[model samples]
Target: MTGKRATQLALLGVVILLVAGLVTGAIGAAITGRDPLLPTPGIHLAPQLITGEARGETTKEVFSTDFVLTNTILSSLITSVLLVGLFWLGTSRLKVVPGRLQSMLELIVEGLLGFMESVIGAARSRSLLPLIATIFLFVLFNAWLGLIPIYQSFGITRWTDLSLTELSKAHVTDVKGKPTITVEDLKHVVEAREAAAISASGKSEAAVEKEAHKFAETNRIEITDAGTIGKQLVVDGNPVTVEGQRYAGKAAEKIQEAGGKVKTAQAGLSAAFLRPAGTDFNMPLALAIISFFFIEILGLRALGLGYLSKFNFIGSLLRFKLIDAFVRFLELVSELVRLLSFTFRLFGNMAAGEILVLLSAFLVPFVITDIVYGLELFVGLIQAVVFAGLTIVFAAVAVAGHEEEGHTAAPEHKQPEHGGGHS
Candidate 1:
């Protein structure tokens, strides 16, 4: 096919797919009684095949398995393995006339080395290439991997419990010996109940919250004695009962059936099996720590114990130069701040992008999601380059500290000599 014709055909196919997806999603929503635009992306701290117990119960101890494999860790490991395999295969045999893989590797290495050389010079760039390149490739792979739809879809089922106190404050009735939840408290109660149910059923918390809001807006909550409350209370014009003190809901029922204390369950729910690796704060923090450590090591190797002087304001303090000391103190603060900067920048960008993609997919399904996927690809590449580039710049600054100090001292030495010569 001609290139222009091929492009037109691709666009046609995408339009058809989007139309089909929209129709299918709308039909599914109608059948399921759920909103087609509501996203069910699970957000979790850790990935686990099974959840242990609901939090907030002082009476019982909840313990999960010794180790649960999380998606972040899984993604990191996979990225590392792929990087190793690619480099190994590319460099395995010496090539007089390089093959495609070898040429690609050479191009990437040469490009990075040339860039680093411009900042830190050719000698130091070669030494720093392994660390810089590994970080770039690993982060790049992770960013791209997250764009894959499978990461958002598949995961294990887990349950969370809710406490009554968490839902709302209780008014203790002296005669019936039952706590009555007020109308104001009912919204919170229902939301907690709904969230638990939805999460346990492997739906997203976003969807749960949306449903809870809709239910709360439509319904009014009332509590009275079992005799006066009737068979059910009217909620959003529908009758819902309290079987005892608990709300008549699937979440409450599940808790009761699971032999869990339902005096109001705690908020625990099922989530996606894995969160994107870059979204986890620890991943970026770990990378920052590693980068900083290596930067320090490179500084130490280049300038020995003299590198400590870059941070120490002791000389300024002893000399009674308050301004110098203040500047030095600021420098110290900036050094520490770099860790936070590195950690948050990567985490925030990646996490926000992942969330954006999820929201877009939920709102528009096939069409808009594809556009977001492309944006994420660009964002991922930019982030990887930024991270690696910053590390190189920092390394350059760290190692050049002595040289900077010498340059500063030279002018001082020259000034005295020029004054002496004039005298």
Candidate 2:
């Protein structure tokens, strides 16, 4: 087949797949009696250690773990390993004429080095290349990794429950002479149900009784509301299900066995096993800290003790020039502010981009999601470049001493005596 025809055929295949996905998702939602668009995609603010638990238990402790492991940390480690492996593979064998992988690596390094030279000059760029290049590549790779289906769709299960106070605060009314709990109150009920399950599992009486006491503290309410609270659970980064049927927990099972269905409860919060590293505050904050320390160290190494003058407003204050001292203090403050700016810029953009993609995919799966993925790719690269470029600029500025800008020795000039020049 001609190249053009071949390309057209490939495009046709992709279109067919996307259409199939959309149809599948739509049909699934219809059969389930749930609006695919109504549910917000799961995105957790904090990482969860355990995968599953009963939601809404009054017992404060849900799962047992000695240490915390966040999705961000996992992604960072993965990114680091991938980056090292990639560079090693690409450069392991030096070639007179580069292969595709080696050529691509060289092109990227050379382009970035050239850009750094323009900003900070050649000498410093070489010294700073390792830090700058690593930051750029790491951020870019992590952001792109998030766009992959596996990263978004693979995660651990987490169960979250509301506090007793929250349940007590819920509105209640009477239904058929029985105190009826509304849909809102059902979330609080899950806590009791979970405790009961633990008790039924033949745990210590003290353990079960402790949970019972906590449950007792929760004020009871009538089920005046027609609908039951829906329990949200995630397994494997997608909604929990088995054989085309949603997974039912103990509470759900009991209700279903009694010929009833749940219709109005919140899902348990589940943290994905791998989140984009850049989306986490910890990643950017750590990067910012490293950049700030490096910038300071570069200044000190380049200018020695004189580097202190960058923040030394006390000298101006002693000279009785309050305005100059205040201005210098503001400059010092700006240095600290740079840390905040760097952290927020990276974290905010990455996190927001991820959220936007999630929303778009939910609202219009398949086509718009692909488009958003493309946009994220561009955004990720741009963010990485911006971060690396700023680091280089800051390093350059820091190392350019105050004396270099304001004071320099003049070159010696030769002068001849007016009367002796001829002799």
Candidate 3:
């Protein structure tokens, strides 16, 4: 590597690290004595997960937004743009002895092409290289995209959450048999939640009481309406609103007035991204449609009438008319099964992989999460390769099938003419 090239590589690596840190908010976190969080259940180290009072599920939005720009997107885009800029500069310079970065990129492309050739042969690989590369890029981008922690770190729009458990419900009930809006009622409700949690978990009464007291001591809450907008109330010069007569603090009121940032939560259904690899119906169904079309096209192009041999279009097997028809139909089902199998296989694998990484991160801190993370990255890449590679192999078989058995068909037809001539 020339001095310039070496410098460029070092710079590029630093840029990546910097951008990754920004996206994950790791640099700032390290400075602030915080940790990177994996999106998971049971615990949320950062406010990103959006939680409410304890005691089970939180359906309330931690944050909500309508297509608001997030830090994650910004960081990922910056990283990608910088990487591209560097590549362009290096490639355009066109060094007879390429810079280290250029040389490295070349190696990656060559290695990938070589791998594809091994899987589908040089001729077919050449034809399918573009698709394979597209798949590779998609996988790479999607895997890296989530590393940006901007949106995770801070969000603008949040949801109104209310804890309405049976126990809390009781604590708030007034002397007149109505849930009153009072500090005493709120305190009692908080305590009730603790009791309920321990009881539901089948814990000792003493433990539940201790925990209930602990939670009450720690939480400073001012309950508001369950609606999207909080109703305003002036309680002692401080703005307050009651949800079920529970107060909303002046702090929440002030932020709401000044237009505090809105948080954009995930708006899409999880299923779309989480669909397993080939295990889901989509991948294989796609494969089946794509594979079968080419198969038929090749079958027709090469075998012509002989392609019907797949259905006993020739020979004495047709003598058992019923059996022949049944066999042909059965073979047709194989095409459909291939598609079904491909979809679920990929969906199951990818979904499982993504979920595992999430859960593992929740189990431990990020520092020791390298092994599980590496495994996830590996699985995602392999799945991408397999899906694309199989597509190529199917295409090849479809194109080549007719050519291989093409001669057999003409001979069979000739035998029929010869018999007719004898008769």
Candidate 1: where are CA atoms >4 Å away?
1-34, 37-39, 44-64, 158-273, 405-423
lDDT of 3 by residue, 95-179 (tens): 7787888898677667778977876578766666665655554445444443322322233333232343331343234356454
lDDT values, one for every candidate: 0.64, 0.66, 0.47
Model 2 regions more than 4 Å off: 1-34, 37-39, 50-65, 158-269, 407-423
> On a 0 to 100 scale, what is the lDDT of residue 227 in model 1?
15
Instruction: Give per-model TM-scores.
Output: 0.65, 0.66, 0.46
Give per-residue lDDT, candidate 1, residue 22.
Answer: 67
Selected candidate, larger TM-score, 1 vs 3: 1
Q: Cα deviation in Å at residue 341, candidate 3?
A: 2.8
Sort by TM-score, best first: 2, 1, 3
